[model samples]
Target: MIFPDNRYRQLRAIQAEDFHTCFYCGCIATEFDFAPPKAHWQSYQYRQLSADNLQVPACKECVALLKPCTMGLVQQRREWVHTKIAAKYKKAIGVYLKWNEDELEELDFSLHHSIAAGLKLGEESHRRSNFQGFSHEIDGSKVADVLPAAMPIVLFDKQFDSLKDAILYVCKNYPITQPKLVERLAEQGNNIEAVVMEIQEEQEVAQFQRQLKIQSAAFAKKHNQSARFVSNEVERYLDKELAYSIAEALDLLYEERVKHYR
Candidate 1:
């Protein structure tokens, strides 16, 4: 089953300047080359991708990689448009730093805020009413003693992909000490320099160890031999980029051993 999202639909005619090919497939796609999803992902499989924070791309084919299914080129093509938009906003923020208050307001912050918030949540679940008197707080404690004038308004699609992209954009483009902008946003109790979210580490090891113990105990009762196991928790501490590199190494080693046996 495939579900279309509205933010995907509204993203019909956008692209990043340097974005000449797909990130995964490396296919050349133009702004007109893609069409937006005409609702939302309503199936059981995509629910995990949405709520549980999977890093799967929003293509029909990518969704199908969930072990029991597959998605078509149409689905994959549909999602690159969004990547294009995210890339654009990143560029836009860089451009904004060149302008003053009057010039910045003319860029239409209200419309962008609406679009960004919708992408972060979803169409049906997203509400303008939800943003009333809302503000973003900067936690200087986590990063450095760096004083940011305000928090950047970053929109995350999944727990990792979109959020990381936004962070990279800020770090590459608008990273500076804008005291005036910071002070003004602080006065209003809302910052607009970066998006901040609460990050909680999952106690995966403890949970895994507890489950392993139960399984081992059951096995011992049947055959009186200890069940050996390995921990997969190394993924939690490594950054997503590094985790991929590590997974690749393990996967290649497994393949090599299989080839040697053959």
Candidate 2:
């Protein structure tokens, strides 16, 4: 049971039309959630910190996400809910970034239908995560919320509405896919060029390694050397820092083996 049970009241939107809108996501509000839950105000002084002691209308999902949150204000709860929503739907967000409606239309029926659902989910999650609450009043007096606005992000000499938009833009223009880019961004900070360069370098290294494996097998067979021997010699050279390139390492091993045979 809450201490200030009587003090807990529904936060009223100034406009009647905004009544059913979820204060966190602007979805059709199915229930209400108390910002700084009723149990939190253990003292009258603690309850006095919030001017309104607001209980904002929220969607069921938003309510569930915010259930464990212990924020002191509506704005904080909204921000927390947005962060959770973004994280929960990041894969869908990746789909949104990777493919657009026109591109989906060009796919085969089954593929289009499957991806289209993901794209729609991504779009809704993105929108809900960014929703700001409607204007509201506290005890018949309107007041401004202290909520901070979403800061626009600049990447690749282009300004985007948010980081999500920037990521989507990068996905469209670069060979890098959305998930890989997101992973690298977390690892490499927000430097778009650095992320792209690192991924490109990794791809090059992987390709070279694959080619080396095939070439080394052929080189071993031609030189009458067992593949294991060739591999062991190359590993020894690399471990000793004697050869940088696989070609150079293989050539050195072949020379040494030929001299031994002779």
- List the candidates' TM-scores in order: 0.17, 0.62
Per-residue lDDT of model 1, residues 1-262, tens digit only: 4343323321121234314332222233222222212122334235533221112222332222222222223334334433443333443433333222333445477865644543343421112111111111112112222223223344443232222234444334543333333333335433233222211112344564476456445543544333341113223323335544433533443354323653
Over all chains combined, what TM-score does candidate 1 have?
0.17
The digit string of per-residue lDDT tens for model 2 on 144-250 reads 54445666676656678866667777787778777778778767755766786676798887887687678778887787777777776777877778446787888
Report every candidate's CA lDDT: 0.32, 0.76
Winning candidate number (lDDT): 2
How close to the true structure is residue 212 of candidate 2, measured as C-alpha lDDT? 68
Q: How accurate is candidate 1 locally (lDDT)?
A: 0.32
Model 2 residue runs over 4 Å out of place are: 1-6, 15-17, 43-52, 145-149, 171-175, 186-262
Error of 2 at 121 (Å): 0.7
In model 1, the number of clashes is 12
